[model samples]
Target: MKASPTRVHHAPARALLAATLLSLSAGCTGASPDAEARPQASCAYVIEYDSRTYLGREETDVPVGESLGSATRPACDDTPGDGDDGEGRALMTAFAVKGVDPAVAIAVAEDPGAYRLVVADTVTELPPELRKVTDGS
Candidate 1:
């Protein structure tokens, strides 16, 4: 039996496709050394710092060691209530953990930083390790 022209072409194409898939799978499993240098933020949550609370979900990556601007008009109150009230203003020196009722999907803070996010009736802190450290230096 003679092989059709399409069959012959497909044989080499199949091999090429298999090789390409294998390479892609391998790359996905383990990142190259260069890619590891810059770690990517997988999740984000709201953070209240320096008398200002920032909605982490709004930003792709949480700003660490940086001051976050007020996301609301007239600024948010510094009373440290359950999240923003929309009209309260906050000073620039106070730092507190304001619990946002809405479960804002957020990744864990890198290091030496922590925040609280409310999911339903439960409040969760990412990277759990942050709790181990004390309030003082």
Candidate 2:
């Protein structure tokens, strides 16, 4: 007797796809050890130094000499809170980790560098490594 023509089971293919996704997820989580507690503040923050305006947050902005204070650059944001507030926290979690556009990042600040920042809540001190290094601090 002859057998009828039919498709074979796709279980192996489906299983492979599942395994790949799981491995990818595991790798991502282990990529950064300090990623969990780190603040989700915009790495793309705007900057205004000595009347000169610049785009994006710079690692060298926070002065490590002379004094310690917050608001190294005026951060004009509609969501005032830095992922510590209700709205900012919710927006970050819903969109980023979930991989869904549950919230939209509105143009929070217009003319970003034009505002003055009053440091409150936290006292930001300069990093110890840059104590002797002066970039017009």
Quantify all predictions' global Cα lDDT against the true fold. 0.36, 0.32
Give the top-scoring candidate (lDDT).
Answer: 1
Clash pairs of candidate 2? none
> What is the per-residue lDDT of model 1 for residues 63-123, given as tens digits with 9 covering 90 to 100?
2233233222134333334343534433222122232222322223322454322122133
- Evaluate residue 115 in candidate 1 and report its C-alpha lDDT on the 0 to 100 scale: 32
Residue pairs in collision within model 1: 43-106, 43-107, 44-106, 44-107, 45-106, 51-94, 76-88, 77-88
User: How would you encode candidate 2's per-residue C-alpha lDDT over 36-123 as one tens digit per residue?
Assistant: 6554444335333223333422222222111111213353444343454322221110001111111211011223222212111222
Query: Can you tell me which runs of candidate 1 are displaced by over 4 Å?
Result: 1-8, 31-41, 46-137
TM-score of each: 0.24, 0.29
Q: 52, model 1: CA deviation in Å?
A: 23
Which has the greatest TM-score? 2
